[model samples]
Target: MKYTDTELEKTLNELGKATYAGEVDVVDKVMNRLKEAENKEKFSIQKERKVRWTIGTMSLAAASVALLLFIGNSSSSQAQNENDGMAKFISEIYNRQSQADVVYYTPDYIDILLGIEGMDENI
Candidate 1:
């Protein structure tokens, strides 16, 4: 299928003088196809960008929700810990109340209990 130099020169000279008068709309057809392909390419690129943006936004929202849930759980656990401590404190108060005969010693009673004889004279 290789052309000799003389054949190549003759083909080029013919192409230079040739006109598409018999196929009047060939140029328009080619241009229309090119335009359609360009539009499809542009739409494809735009659609791809939209998909990427949507995925990114959704991922950010999901991460934000996860972070909020984690913070809420930690705060709830801290509150539960405080509530447990408060319940223990309340139980201790009830136990103290139930010991009705528990005596509080003044300084003199402490000295008597400790067998210190000169505490009265010191007072």
Candidate 2:
């Protein structure tokens, strides 16, 4: 499209006058809308940050609890193993005590009692 220079000047002059008179209510409405959108964006960003922090804290707490439980179970198993070892040691000691220095006698005791020639003193 082509316009004469005169027509362009006239259109520019009218636009200038309208702007100077503050007759551009659409611009003001657009500015207000932009400000509101910026405020809402800021609020949403802050809300997202808070939610992320809460989730992070909860995850850390859960991890700590899990670690504690793992430690407790490991310690309990170790203690049980020690108790089992002690019980085995005690049983071995009891068995040794019961078998100490007991003499057996058969009809062979009569030969030793009479001091026979083939009697062995080792018994």
Judged by TM-score, which candidate is best? Answer: 2
Taking the tens digit of each residue's C-alpha lDDT, what string does model 2 give over 1-123?
899999999999998887464545688889999999999999999999999999999999999999999999999999999989878865755555466533442335434443553656554
Model 2 CA lDDT for position 98: 61
Q: Which ten residues in a row have the lowest lDDT in candidate 2?
A: 101-110
Model 2's lDDT to the true fold?
Answer: 0.77
Q: Report how far residue 70 has shifted in candidate 1, in Å.
A: 1.5
Candidate 1 ranges with C-alpha deviation above 4 Å: 1-27, 96-101, 104-123
lDDT of 1 at 84: 95
Q: Which ranges of candidate 2 are over 4 A from the true structure?
A: 1-24, 99-123
Whole-model Cα lDDT per candidate? 0.82, 0.77
Clashes per model (N, Cα, C within 3 A): 0, 0
